[model samples]
Target chain A: MRKLFSSRTVVTIIIAFIVIVGLITGSNWLSKRTNTPPFVQRFSNDLAGGVSRLISVPTTAIGRTANSIGNLLDTFEENQILKAKIDQFAQDKVRLQTVEEENRSLKKQLGLQATLTDFKTVSAVTISRSPTTWQSQLVINQGIKAGLKKGMPVLSGAGIIGRISEVNTTNSKVALISDTSEDANRFAITIKGNSGEINGIITGFNREKNQLIMGQVTSDNTIKAGDLVETSGLGGVIPSGLFVGKVARVTKDDYGLSKRIYIEPAADLGNITTVVVAVSEIGAK
Target chain B: MAFWQLTRIRVVYPVILFFLLFVDGAVMSGMGAFFTAFPWHVLPLATLIWLFYGVQFDVDKDMPFWIYVTATGILFDAYYTGIFGTYTVAFLIATMVMKQAKNILDERLLSGLTMFLFGILTFLVITYFAGYIIGIANVSIVTFLLFEVLPTVALNAFFAVIGYFPVWSFFNFLR
Candidate 1:
């Protein structure tokens, strides 16, 4: 015991502990920051991103091939189901086109250049998602050169999945909606109910239930299960009318003072191969 | 040390770790795609890092590995977690723990599994607390275990068993 507790050894232990604490504190500070990282950090991230992008070309190809094969088993039935929907969709398309044209002309007449729903999108391949469950981040191949700014909402073919958390020169990280990290940007969402649109904020996720927990709802609006939830665009960060998901349930907080709504996310947060980064046209000419 | 041996330590090990880290990400992408319901993830790199110390290197040869461990942890934090010191501190301490743990457990398959559990468990705990301190992690301990730790153990233990022999053979070949 005395040998183990030698003066030199004790000094070393204390120094190591201090170093560890400093590292944790320093890293935590860096982790929460959204600005451009140090040169060393950027260089390292770029190098890794380059490698992942090179590898993703093959991996994503293989993933899609495997996915198509899996979908083949259900294709016949899905074809039958889709054929029926296509006819209905064809009629809806013409009606939607007419309505859109009228709305566009009316907006032009009103001298409105951009609205909350105005945005442009850039497509990018997803190299990978962070292995850790807590992180819930996706590494995309486009970055600063691609005009991807921080806080840009990312969408899969299905719907909005997350927002850009970090941007490097050739790559960016999207913090997924499922991410429980405190630094993650919260999504301001609205649920279309029988009465009207009920607004709320996405706060956390219930991993066990596979549901997104929407909180800070002061409204007692009649929100039913299966109601379409979309970005309200109240915050002006995320575009309005972007499909988020349908309401899964409405429950009370533990204190019973506030309402907690659970959302079944539209995007398959589990499997994302490609995404589009939504660049808001808020100030764009 | 021979020139070749030094090269293996300085160059080969880091190169191999880089690929292994990439494999973790690649495996994770496929796993997320196919096994959507299975939230348990495999950290082969974490297991491999432990194998580098606990099973392969005697403590005397551990000096160089500290640098490797630190570099690897920093890259992991920068590349994936974005929380720089979380993996660095966790992996560094786990390697220190591995030195003691290696003494108690032989380098058999079962022992390798135990070490993997030790390495990953320590990583989760240290990182969880670090995340908590940094205000990132919000899940309860029970949720962490259920969602993160248990599934990682289940998958990575099998990975540890299968990977142990190859890594052991490689280390012995280096010897």
Candidate 2:
């Protein structure tokens, strides 16, 4: 006993034991002693309740303040994010407005069709971009629910934009003709005198230049620069007589059987934010 | 010189805890922007910190321990900021576990070391689970681990360091 009391380890162990025992015994005593003299018990209960209230009040106040401050900071951060998004949308709105005005002027000048013939148009917003080497696709914020069925022709004011490949509840994926390996090509023949069929693949090669390439045209066909390339209506993918692009340059092959024609795409694929998806009129043929 | 005598000794530790809670709220809210996954929460961090502090300190001496534990839980579960009650349950269980562990590692130094280890481990598990549960696809594991655990550990340690002197003095005065 003397040795145990003399050591620091023993002293610490004893202190711990006493504390544990005291806590257990005290709790047990309180539980058992609840049935006591009425006045004395009432007074003790009131004191305990008052102490509990005192402890609770400050803790609750601090907690409320902490929560409010946290909420305030969150509100400030969220407001900043919302403000940034609004600014981006505002700039986009201005560009879109300019485009809309220019499109109205072009429509009045061209007088192509009163309502672009028969194709149904659905408005879609660009939402996301896929990361890939050659297969660049975009997710648009319109889906099957928005009357955007699969294989629908997408377009900007200039001409045919792309096609809807995938559809979801609130979004759809579009595969642009410019994406490498996409063979969304169709035959085009001019409507003027000496009309001849020309087979060319349409692709968006340079985004910044807004250029689409139409190659593999037969050398026998007399084609000129600025000749309008319209859908031959033969490919079954795109509608007949829809404007694709204009012939920019033509180069004869080694054998001279076919000519590779460079065509500038009518649609500006780079800056496309909103597009009109043309829903196919089933059984309209 | 006479500050100790003028102030109520009983209220000191709780007051310090209250102040630290405020700092914790601010720093964690700022960090939440980065730490947030799909569901949007910072409870895991708060729970981990509360547990570490409970385990390392003399929690047995905490008067009306349930009150503080409940308060910590309420503060941790600010889900109106996002989804509700995700943090409250986490903090309550965490503090309870730490209180149990405190019985075993009673010494300050040993408890502190254990607290640091637990702090790191809990942070990792919570972040991993947060990502998994919330379906945050495309973020790398290394990026998640570094961002989630490292900042929290550093921040908690910073607070602990600043708090050490005051805590020590208060305990010493009480003794």
lDDT of each: 0.74, 0.50
Residue A74 lDDT, candidate 1, scale 0-100: 100
Candidate 2 CAPRI level: incorrect
True contacts kept of 1: 0.39
lDDT for residue A233 in candidate 1, whole number 0-100: 84
lDDT value for model 2: 0.50
TM-score against truth, every candidate: 0.89, 0.35
Error of 2 at A13 (Å): 58
Candidate 1: residue A102 Cα off by (Å): 1.8
How well is each residue in A67-131 modelled by candidate 1, as lDDT tens digits? 88988999999999999899999999999899989989999999998899789989998886676
Task: Report the lDDT tens digits of candidate 2 across residue range A81-198.
Answer: 8987998899999998998788778878998443323356678655333221123345566764686655667786687767765454455656666543232232333322145656
lDDT at A18, model 2: 64
- Which stretches of candidate 2 lie above 4 Å from their native place? A1-117, A183-210, A282-285, B1-175
Error of 1 at A259 (Å): 1.8
Residue range B69-121, candidate 1, lDDT tens digits = 77877887889877666777777777767666777889666675676567667
